[model samples]
Target: MVIRHGQASFGADNYDKLSDLGHQQSAAVGQALRDMGWVPDRTITGTLTRQKETLASMGFEAGEEHAGFNEYDFQDLLSARYKGDVPDLVKGDRKVHFRTLRETVFQWQADEIENPAESWGTFTGRVESARLAACATGADRVLAVSSGGVIGQLTAASLGAPDKMMMTLNLQIKNTSITKFVFTNSAFFLHEFNATPHMMSGEAAGMLTYS
Candidate 1:
């Protein structure tokens, strides 16, 4: 199962570490996996601090830290595409920023970028390569911590899902959400996407986010 890192601290300059709530969310994911008898034979994570910290919080020390699982820097992509100008539509208002960001991301998914730091082909290729490599290890169940974009690409490719479905799935995945995939001889089969049942009513509801 590929697990996304939990809710990150918002508005922090780093944006790579889990907030206090993030830690709780990570632990909840771990507990859920345990409930399902889904302890991974080999655990892996991207080199990002949030990924690493999420794994640690889950009480599993990841054996291999793989750069292949690392996410393309979206901040860099936005800067490159927009030439460092915050789009007028997203200026000042947090809600507007997120709304515009969602639209911008869909444009990105559709392969529309005015100026790109990395081609979409390149980004997906790297993520696919890493996923294939992890499957090659022959582990019964491998767990990886990654970001939403990478997960969305992998899930979309594996299921042959449409662009609209991909965008919707991307919009729905929350921090610390679980997305499961089954691998057979390096071929991926997606089983579940965005499963988070550990958060109790109000607490879990509070953890929900679109971005």
Candidate 2:
């Protein structure tokens, strides 16, 4: 299971932290997994604070910390794309921000943007390495906590989708949602993508967040 970090401090000075709703969503995920009798024997998380916090909120102790699972810096991408000055509206409004982000990522994938700390190729390679290492543990169930960017790219790659598909996938992946991959015969196959069984019904349904 690969899960996106919960609702983050979007539009804040520090977007690395989880919001209150994020905590609730994480806890709900934990309960939902337990109810399904799908507990994992091993867990891994990106080195980001939000990823670590999400793992904790899900009632799991800290597991392995891998920088390969870390998200590519969107702020850095925007800065590189805009040559350092992003428009105020893009920074302030959620809709505008996402729209701009999608376009920027598209450009980044096409090698149109430059100077980002990590290039598109670098990001993808790192994620692939992380996935391989995580699956190498031979655990029956391995849960990984990561950001949408990493998950999106992984999902797209798994489907043999074009480079631009990651942008679309990234935009729609909900917080704390699970994407399952089965690694066997030295290969990883996608079993599911973007499932939120936890918030399927009841008041928890209102907790779904795509950001």
Using TM-score as the measure, which candidate wins?
2
What ranges in model 2 sit over 4 Å off?
Answer: none
Among the numbered candidates, top lDDT falls to 2
Using all chains and alpha carbons, the TM-scores for the candidates as numbered come to 0.87, 0.98
| lDDT digits (tens) for residues 49-96 of candidate 2 | 999999999998898988989999999998998889999998899999
**Number of clashing pairs per prediction, in order:** 0, 0
Provide the lowest-lDDT 10-residue window in model 2. Answer: 181-190
Note each model's CA RMSD in angstroms.
Answer: 2.4, 0.9
Whole-model lDDT, model 2: 0.92
* Model 1: per-residue Cα lDDT at residue 180: 87
